[model samples]
Target: MSVDILIIEDEPGLSRMLATTLGAQGYAVSTAMRADEALARVAVDDPALILLDLGLPDGDGLQLLPLLKQRCQAQVLIVSARDQESDKIAALDAGAEDYLTKPFSVAELLARLRVAQRRRQEAAPVTQCYRAGELVVDLDQRQVSLAGEPVKLTPKEYQLLAILAQAGGRVVTHAQLLQAIWGRHHSDDTHYLRIYLRQLRQKLERDASEPRYLLTEPGVGYRLGDGTA
Candidate 1:
């Protein structure tokens, strides 16, 4: 299927390479070298996925992540030269879906793109229920099940899962979850998120330590994944 993709990289050579490659793959491609231009293009194009390079000329991609997220619901995949563990975690926390270190092969990049595309396709708005493998979250009737058995959940637990379900497997930052559930004043209360997420995992996951549905994004927040991968 044809997909709209945005390449937000500052390096001219790298950006051109990406645009050419993606265009050849049947994707509609656009490029931006600065954060401002990226935002403007996003407003006009409404891309489905964004391949972002952290070291933009105007501002870092880390700084632009939240803004991009707020402006459009495009899935962001950070493709950067920064290979530090901390950089990956920071990008995830800033709301990037996946990270790829620089000097990657075409095969590796294509593999990553496949995963992102699968997630985006799965995340498409559910008309009634959301299914991730055996787990089912019935949005229309407010019910949840695992392995075809009913799963009892508190109002808050169900609410949290509902939010994640609606997200369509994308990472939902801690602040976003807190504000949605607890209120804007409580958006920074990471403690609440920790408690609630833990509780939800206990109920939803076969092994809470190795969660699938209630996946943790380390210092960032959480996302719901099929976990088959």
Candidate 2:
């Protein structure tokens, strides 16, 4: 059976209310009151989306956020009573796709769910291989080559390259690329990107100083060059 929603909230009343409300909308909903239970449920249910609460009986949900993101394919939307900006940022940076403070309206929750689902759909890959100039990226094969010569890459290097190639020449923001490769916690870690980008240019470009295919957008982000020499 397909599970669309998993509500990982400790409060029985709130969990039941959310389950009832979402079930009424024709979504298959599951609930877990503890962190371990939620992890097990996620393993079994493989829900498309999760409504998580940070304050749990057994553990802090913020600590569990990265684990959940690593283990599950679900888009986590944190619904918690923690209203502090730090809490919100920490949850988000820990990989929660979105954060919702408690006492939230059902309407807003549903709307945000819709937005998350839409974004997921948009981000889904439509193609496997991307080509620009002499560089060829076969995403499915997890390989990159230049001028038909195989180019070995570290996992992180390939990840950064794949993200840029996936953009199809459009600029991918530093934050977006960082989050995609290094998790949301490192979204501001541009130094990592810079170091990796430099390495990628060395391997893939004939001239690392004047990069050909890996184009930087200065203050914005980076994108694959327009297949031009």
Candidate 3:
């Protein structure tokens, strides 16, 4: 049977509580008490999401973030006692999609999990052809064009553009973009995003200085230009 969620938490009581609660809600939940065990289970279970706690008897959960991201497509949500801002940012940059400090209410945990599942459902393959002014993205084909001409983009740049395009006109936060592209550990590296955004503008914009399709929201994030000529 397939697992919908994997809880990689070392605390037996908390693990049982999570499993029991989530299972009651009609989710197929799996639990692992150590990092190595979690990795092994992930390989076999093919879970859609993971609830990870950083402190483990064998290894640190934060250290496993990148490996888990590389090995599986599951969305990882960090559940740890480390409440420091640096720890949260580090986890986010390391590839974790969300972080919930300990002492959190079970109701909130369930709500967050539901949101993550909903996003996955929405992002699942359907017909996706995005357009913003002269730029066109055929998501199904993984191709892009500018003013009827094909445009070339590095894998990372394409990923960035694809995310913005997927958002339609809504703003994609810096943390979101960074976590999506470079992993969670790089969330605070806004400079990296800036450098890439400049490259994208140069390649896709008629005038990089005054971009029309790709727009920046100072102190917030970025958005694809509204689909207006």
Which candidate tops TM-score?
A: 1
Candidate 1 lDDT over 61-142, as tens digits, reads: 9999999999997889999999986788678768788999999998898888888888778765647688888899999899
lDDT of 2 by residue, 106-143 (tens): 99999989977865664566667887788999999999
lDDT of model number 1: 0.86
State residue 203's C-alpha deviation in candidate 2, in Å: 29
lDDT of 3: 0.85
Worst 10 residues of 2 by lDDT: 118-127
lDDT of 2 at 114: 90
Ranking by TM-score: 1, 3, 2
Tens-place lDDT per residue, model 3, 1-229, is 4699999998999999999999999999999998899889989999999999999999888888898998888878899999887677678657676778999998999988986786567564468987667789888899999889999999989999999888655457789898889898998899988999999989988888888888986666787884342
lDDT of candidate 2 at residue 103, scale 0 to 100: 94
- Highest lDDT, which number? 1
**TM-scores of all candidate predictions against the true structure:** 0.77, 0.60, 0.63
Poorest lDDT segment (10 consecutive residues) of candidate 1 = 119-128
Flag regions of model 3 displaced more than 4 Å: 127-229
- For residue 130, model 2's alpha carbon misses the true position, in angstroms, by 14
What are the lDDT figures for the candidates, one per model? 0.86, 0.85, 0.85
Q: Rank the candidates by lDDT, best first.
A: 1, 3, 2
RMSD of each: 3.5, 8.2, 6.9
- Candidate 2: misplaced stretches above 4 Å? 127-229
